[model samples]
Target chain A: MATILKVEGLWKNFGGLTAVSDYFLELPEGEIYGLIGPNGAGKTTVFNLISGVLKPSKGRILFQGIDITWFRPDQIAALGLTRTFQNLRLFPSLTVEMNLRIAYHTHARSGFLAALLSTPSFFREEKEIGQKVDRILELFEMSDFREEIASSLPYGWQRKLDIARALVCEPQVLLLDEPSAGMNTKEAEDLAVLIRRIHEEFRLTMMVVEHRMPFVMGLASRIQVLDYGSVIAFGTPEEIRNNQKVIEAYLGVGDLIA
Target chain B: MKQGIRAEWYFLLGGLLLFGGAFLATQFLNRYLLYILVLMGIYSIATVSLNLTNGYAGLFSLGHAAFMAIGAYTSTLLTFPLALREAYELPMLPAFLGGPNFVWPFFPAICMGGVLASVAALLIGAPVLRLRGHYLSVASLGFVVIVTTLAKTMKGLTRGPMGISAIPSYTNIYWTYLWLLITVYVIWRIVNSRFGRAMMALREDETAAQVLGVYPMKYKLMSFVVGAFFAGVAGGLYAHFTKAIRPFEFSFFLTFQIVVMLILGGMGTTAGPIVGAVSLLTLRYALKPLEEHLKIYGLIEIIYAVLLIVVMLFKPEGLVGQKRGVKKITVGGKSSA
Candidate 1:
């Protein structure tokens, strides 16, 4: 399979401190890749760099053969990559459906003039968006909460909604940042299953930045472990689990890896 | 289908109310009352236009008066009656502007005024909009001050402190209300669509919106330019109606009053700003006689300040604030999890 995303020698420096240095990733189309690290390992920073939220100090990122290293966030998304925040970053006051629709903006073809005039083409595109929103909601089993304000949703549901929002843009690549951070084991397990289902359903290339061991191990085919902004190991989940450096990076020497 | 019917009914009701109001203005109401109504309509346009930026897009701009001033000046120059142009001694009127025997019609001139204001907005917004929150507010306020200073010093174009008088009275009850309806309709259409939703998304959380593929600059600049366009239109109407154009009139005080109307009515809702304009304008007119009777010149503003404080304390969302819990969430909606 062709590489959907290629990150080469990525580095991010925040003032005097290096947040990320010489990080590399090559995610194949339709592959599920996991990034796991300790508190300051710069997992979220890598996601930010790929999604164009922050510029890399030194790196190149190619999305589907296009160099998107310097693209703006919206431009990156328009080229079919979307990301979710580690902290819930939903449009709090917007309804669930509207939240999805706003994400659907890049795909929608109507402009300000069409909106102002309410032209037939505008109505057609709006109906299409409504239908797309309905399908996404139903797929997520969030049809019941379609009218609920995003902020008012329960914690688990809000997380689901955030993922759903990213998916609505029909992105070829999805970056999920600490998606299971606040979830209990059972909730995280359910999320893992939902993500697997989404992967199969959409055939997407996904990069998950996670701290949950079982969740990432069960969902991702390959895992990369980071310590102090440098990759310690990159292999299949089983190899990464037993790697001496990764185990030491996560639990220190002589400690159980899992 | 049901929503369509309800909307039609609303249109009918609004039309009836408008007709009756126009009737009263033309027949029953005294000239002073009619004048107040016209002023009310003009202020409503200005307030509604400002709401598109401050209320919906979450850009707290204070330069609306500057855009209006641009519109006012642009339209005034275009429609200044060619005969009067020769009489005014406009030293800086280039051949194209001060050319003999030519006066543009009202509609195009007003539109040109709005276009020019929007152009100005585009020029200013491209850089100024990059700043967020209080910084953006201060930048916009500085823009208003700069425009006022330019109006004061641009003696050839604006006649400096002397200002310009003898402007034709092209605005009336009908013209003012027509523009109000158009403004409301355009903004309402915008707010209910994808463009407006993207704006609200930015307002709620810009970072999230950007990740979702909303280019923040595009939406921000679009809202700012659109808002400035209508504000310019309002300026043109004010210039024509008042039969005078003055730099001092389109200063911070005017912007403050429009901002007050937006807050008092409610931000983010279509009806809020209009209600605010009507309520505040009515109070100002009503208190005019009382202030004169008691010889307390600043009583009107004092009352306004008190009302604003009380509203802020009790209903910070303004009068027409959207109720958070009001949407019908009952698709077997057994409380949120």
Candidate 2:
């Protein structure tokens, strides 16, 4: 399979501390890639670098062979790569539907003048986008609370909305930072199943950062283990489970019970 | 669809009746009432325009008066008589600018004022908008101080401390009333569009806004320019109505008053600023005559402070703010409740 993302020798320095160093990644098209690490192992920083929130100090990032080392975050998103925060980041005061619509900003084809004047094309596109969002909301079982303020939604629903928001822009690559962070074990299992379904339904690549070993192991086709700003091991779930450095980094024998 | 049409018709009819009443007042009412009405109209422009940045985009700028001053001076330098221009030593400008007046008409002068103010905002917004929260406010306040000092020192164009007196009383009910309507309409249209939602996203969380593909700097600069443009126009109207221009008139106090109007009316909504501006100005006007006999300084401003405190204590969101909250959330839904 062709690679959708290629990161070569990526490094980030925050003054004295080196957060991430010499990180390399190659994610194949339509495959799920998992990045696992202990606390403060720089998984989120790597996501930030790829999303263009932080410029890599020394590295090259290629999305489909186009260098995006210094592109702005919005520009990177417009180029069809988007992400969700580890902590939920929804437009708090906006309604759930409006939150989804704003995520669809890049897809809004109506020009500014047209929208201001409420022209025919603007309304037509708006109605079509509305229909599309309605379908997604129903798919995610968020149809019952579309009018609720995003801030007021139940925690699990907010997490679902964050994932839904990441997909509305039709991104080719989706980076999910700790999607199962606050989920109960049952919810995490459901999320693992939902992610499997999503991987089957959508023709896109995914990179997920998760600390929950079982969730990551079951969902990802390939896994990379990071310890203290470096990739310690990379392999299939069974291989990574037995890797010596990965076990030692996680502070115990590899407990693969789940 | 039917509901939208009904609302539009009601808005048109209400506008016509209000305009009719204003026309009658100009022809037959007392000067004091007309003066108060005109003042409210000008402030409506200032507060409503300021809402674009300070409220919707969450910029919290404290230099709105600086933009107003730019508009006032730009319009004044253009239309002040040739004799007045010759009196000031305006060597900094081109020879033609210092020699004869541009002598443009009323509307053109006001437009030029808005244009020049927007230009200044464009130059300043790029650097200043990077700072967030109180840092942004202080930076903007510094801008106001700079503009004020320049006006006091520029002796040539501004006539130094002696400001340009004898400016024509060209701004009447027509000019102010029309500008107020235009300001409200333009802001209303933009705030209801996709661009407005993008702005609110930036206010919610800028990092998330970027991940969602809303560029912060582009929309921030746009709102800043729009707000400054209207502030400049309002300043021009005030200069003509008062028949004088002074550096002290466009001071920190003026910016404070407009900012108060925005917060008291509920910062994010179109109706909040209009409601806030008119009621506050009316209260101040009613108290103006009591100052000399009461012998207390800034009694009117004290009353405003109390009202703001009361709003913060009880209905902290202002009277119209929750309505704005409802505006974005419940669009196109059949359930009204």
User: Tens-digit lDDT track for model 2 on A122-150?
Assistant: 66777777887897798788998898888
* Weakest lDDT window of 10 consecutive positions for candidate 1 chain A: A249-258
Model 2 clashing residue pairs (backbone): none
Q: Give model 2's DockQ, 2 decimals.
A: 0.33
Kindly report, for each predicted structure in the order presented, the TM-score of its chain A compared with the true chain A.
Answer: 0.97, 0.96
The parts of candidate 2 lying over 4 Å away from their true place are: A252-258, B1-14, B82-102, B323-337
Clashing pairs in 1: none
lDDT of 1 by residue, B1-337 (tens): 1142356457658867996789777898889989999999999999999999999999999999999999998888888876677689654345675555567788888998999999999999999999999999999999999999999999888988778899888988988888888888788877878788888999999999998888999989989999999999999999999989889998998998999899999999889999999999999998899999999999998998899999988888899987553433223222111
Question: What is the Å distance of residue A35 in model 2 from its true position?
Answer: 1.1
lDDT by residue for model 1 (A1-258), tens: 899999999999999989999999999999999999888898889999999999999999999999999999999999999999887798888789889988898888887787776677877888788888898898889999998988778778888999999999999999999888677789899899899999999998899988888899998999999889989899999999889888778777774434
Candidate 1's error at B60, in angstroms? 0.4
